[model samples]
Target: MQLVVKPVPDTASNQCLTESCAWHGFDTNPPFEDIVELHYTGYHEKKKFASSREDLGEPLRTEIGTGKVIKGWDEGIVSMFEGEIARLVIRDDFAYGAYGYPPMIPGGATLTYEIELLRIEKPTSNHKLKPSH
Candidate 1:
């Protein structure tokens, strides 16, 4: 699969990855961190596989730079501002890899996602939130 990322004009934002994956989006003031809530549409082989839209109940929440979600998502979601949307394309190595994720994902498959940043929440105190496994 092909991966591409480039600067978006005068915006300080830039592509996150360009080898195994690619992402294009804007940067937030505080940057994506400790925790975030967002919506996403996941696609495999150009077919809709999963999503976290409004109709799908609560928006998904996760900690950044943590292995809580797929590697591709971690690399792509950072630095994105709330209300910003972007496309993240990832190869197998950054996704579920050769073993895949059961029936939802296949071995060595390339996946794409249309992710929208809904909110960013920083920790209230100095205590850090533990990364969910």
Candidate 2:
């Protein structure tokens, strides 16, 4: 039997990982314990991989600078302002990397997220906010 091999494309060095996000304004600066509501659609190889239905699903709510999500997402969201829309381009190291995310994200895949920041809110007591050491 013969073995087959496939090459993984790096998407042109993955566009500098998380990219340099532009700060919208300082009037509404992001706090360490700030919570955010946002909508996003993820894509790899220019095909949609993840997202919720616009009519049925609620926006994702999470704390900023937390590792709850991927590294790229956390960093990208930190630079955004309320009601701002932007795209985040992330490389494998910041994304799923060599192992990838099962059947969805392939190995060495570069992920892109079209995101909209709904709101930046003060952390409610219910949220577990821990200072990053």
Candidate 3:
């Protein structure tokens, strides 16, 4: 399936260079290596449902650092910082495609997620919550 690329606003207006993404330059400034803990509020849109029983409104509370989820969460979460809010426009390639969610995400479907980075935590050898880098 062909993935439709939704142009980010800054990039679409030619306001920034490709090497430096305008989206990356937002208020969010978490370190690249820091593990991002976030609370995202968004919805998934597809032609059909991923699950026959589950509704589409089921919000996803993902702990991104553990690599326990989809590729979009893995990549998108790292690009945000504590308290940063982003409107993520995801393509089918980044989400469950072709054979969707066993039955919510459908094949060749696109999804959008409005994400908010609520917290950032640093891993420390000591038993203290290390300051965000």
Best candidate (score: lDDT):
2
TM-score of each: 0.71, 0.72, 0.52
lDDT of 2 by residue, 44-73 (tens): 989988884453287777777667677677
Q: Where does model 1 exceed 4 Å of error? A: 1-33, 124-133
The order by descending TM-score is: 2, 1, 3
lDDT of 1 by residue, 1-133 (tens): 2444432224222232322223333455224356877888888989988887644676776777667777767766664556666677777877888988878899998888777777778856664554431
Task: List model 3 lDDT by residue over 21-123, tens digit each.
Answer: 2233245544444455544433465242232124324333334535455555556666554565565555566666666564445576556555556566565
- Evaluate residue 21 in candidate 2 and report its C-alpha lDDT on the 0 to 100 scale: 33
Model 1 clash pairs are: none
Better of 1 and 3 by lDDT: 1
Pick out the ten consecutive residues of candidate 1 with the lowest summed lDDT.
12-21
